[model samples]
Target: MELSWSTFLLEILNFFVLVWVLKRFLYRPIQSVIARRQQDIDARLAEASAKEAQARRLQDDYEDRLAQWRSEREQSRQALEQELRGEKARREKLLAEDLEQQRARSVAVDSRRQGEQRRQLELQAMEQGSRFAAKLLEQGAGPETEARLLSVFLESLAEMPEARRLQLCAQLRDTPKEAQLQVASAYPLDGGMRNKIEQALTACLGRPVACRFTEQPELIAGVQVSMGAWVMGVNVRDELQGFAHLAPDSVGG
Candidate 1:
């Protein structure tokens, strides 16, 4: 129980020594381990931040590519529509041209058909007129008509060209001895008429020429004079036939 200063001082010194040993060995090594763990955590945080930045850049690039693809697709669709419209317009034009040509051809064919029909109708009318005229002349035949025709015949002979008259005269004179001079008339000639005809023939030939007279009703209303192969006459039948032949040209003109 009495106070001991030496022992007390000794105990205090022992406590200080224990404190120094713990600081130099145990506390310093544990503090170093804690510092290294903190550095590893900081490095991991930095690496995570870098990876996030790279991912953001890749996302932005992908969005840009998608927008470009959409623009290109829209342009292609517009170009295709324009081409289809042009093709349609071209087809319509070709169809319209074909229709016009067909219409023109049909018009031409119709015009030609109408012309042919008109020509045929005109020819038929002309034929009918010719027949009517022939019938009228046949019914009107008479002595007066016959006498007029005979006078015309004589006048025609007198009006003949001088060369033609001379040629006929020469032909008559040089006729074969056995050949007959024939005179044909629509009506029978009386003795006085026959004598008159013989006198005219003799004067034209410059010689007495024997004649044979024949009554032929088909002469219409005229007289025919024949010597060898030569014959001369005028009749309504010849005029009608000439008119018939010329009718087509008259209608066309």
Candidate 2:
């Protein structure tokens, strides 16, 4: 290639002009588009970070609400258990009191019934005793038995009062006027029962009394004085008969 000063100058000027045109028209517009794109990318990243923070806050809130509900449910369960236990204890106490009252009532009823039974038995025994007493009084005296007759009469005479006995003696004195009657015999007339009877008759009659020496085996063992229409005899047989009528339970175990 041949080097010429004018042709080299003209080539250098054309190269400079082409670089300025590219910078002003094509390179500047391209650089502006790239910068705008980078700004958009940064805005998108900031929006993503905000959304993540909001989601975390919502999750925390849900967890707190669930914990509170669980706490309330446990407290309610414990309260219900306590109420049921109290009710059961009260029921048991009531049942025990009822049973004790029933037991006391039963004991009282049994005791009253036993007392009634004992009283009934005693009444029946008393009725039987009265009937026996009437029967013994009906059987009268037998004759020819002096010792037994006197014993029977003496036992019957002892039952009367002293005033009533004097009245009977006065009646006897007026009735039998020479009847030579014996009056009251002395108690426990030991060995001289016959002599005592004769003396009493002598005094009541106002005359001498002849004593009879007759033994009456029919009479059980007592003095009997008889002077015409008036006779009194005490007999041991009547005593034995009265005792026989008593109930076995009254005398035995």
Candidate 3:
């Protein structure tokens, strides 16, 4: 409570000394520690920023790889579809060609079979017609037809060529005068017809000739003159045989 100059001055001096000690020993060291802690915090923040940028770059690369894979998968799927379509079209075309070939072959075979059947029918008809004609002629043969055939035969002998008559005369000249000239017919010849035939033979040969008459039912309404190897005839049997030979033959289809 007493205001003394000396004591006051002493108190002021102690206060100044305490301030210098705190500045030198506590304040300066505390400020140094705070600066070091601030530097450590700044370095950790820079490292965190760099790591974040690297993570972003990695994510972008992964996304690009995924997009490229999807594009490649789409391309492969489209190519497979196109190949399947082409293969299907080729198989269908081959099937169509094979079917057409089979149809054409079937048609050709059917046509050939039809033609063979028609030919067989025609041959059968021809054979039947020949047999019918032969039966009809056989039933119609009689003495009237035989007489007409004999008359035709006599006329044919009268119309014989001079050279043919000479050949016949030469052939008969080697035979004996007493050799019989055989005259065959389908029916019995009357005496007048026989005498006429004998006279004609005598006139044709330029010599007298003996005669012999015979009935040959197999002649079928015609005359056959025979002497040794020489023979001539015109008969219904010969005509029917020629008609039968005209029929066509059957062949393999």
Candidate 4:
């Protein structure tokens, strides 16, 4: 077939028109749809990224809270442990102090008991010793013993203070003028002894006092001169009684 230029040009123009129609109608609309889809995808990706970031932040916050809780728990545990230790220490100190006090009290009680026992033993010893001495003196009572005691008694009266002697003299003088002074002895006194004793009594009284002699075995080897309510004697029994009142050390001495 012979090539026709008009026909060829017409065909080319139809092809261009078809291309233009496709670009304006189908291609443009498809491109717009694709752009919208791309925009949607981009928006979805950005939202996913934001969500992931938020989740990470939440996870970080949760981890921080757990760590803080653990720290607080540890601190509380330490505080409780410290309190228990302090309480234990305080209780131990109190117990120790109480024990010491109890020990001190026990020591004091024991000391006091020991002291009382010692005092009792000393007193018992002193009493026994005094009794033994008195018994010996009583067993040895005789005329010679009575004479010696009488002499000692007279010497003791002579050595008495001037005021005390005068007071005794006055007291004896106040008795009834007819009242006889009695001289008692544990042993029999001979006439010579009686005369000597009478002379001594008269000298002591500063007057001739009425006198009588009597044997009283209870005198325990001593002479007793009695005038009215007054009586003076020196004997083993009186010495033993006086010794009973002495301190243990003095008795031992």
* Highest-scoring model, TM-score: 4
lDDT of 1 by residue, 1-253 (tens): 9879998998889888888888778888888888887788778877887888888888888888888888898898888898889888989988998898888888888877886678678877998898898788889977788888877877776577778878887777668655667999989988887777777766665667778999888777778888768887766666677789888887676
In model 3, where is the ten-residue run with the lowest total lDDT? 244-253
Candidate 3 structure, TM-score to reference: 0.45
- lDDT of candidates 1 onward, in order: 0.80, 0.59, 0.80, 0.84
Residues 131-244 of candidate 4 have per-residue lDDT tens digits of 787788778777788778888987876677888879988887667667788888887878887877777777777777777888787668887888767988776566677788
lDDT head-to-head 2 vs 4, winner: 4
Tens digits of per-residue lDDT for model 3, 71-158: 9999999999999999899888889888988888898888888867777777677668767876776788888888787788677678
TM-scores, each model vs. reference: 0.48, 0.38, 0.45, 0.59
Number of the candidate with higher lDDT, 1 or 2: 1
lDDT of 1 at 80: 88
Candidate 4 wrong stretches, greater than 4 Å = 140-239, 245-253
Task: Pick the lDDT winner.
Answer: 4
After TM-score superposition, what is the CA distance of residue 7 in candidate 4 from its true location, in Å?
4.1
Candidate 1's error at 223, in angstroms? 1.2
Which clashing pairs does model 3 show? none
Residues forming the 10-long window of minimal summed lDDT in candidate 2: 137-146
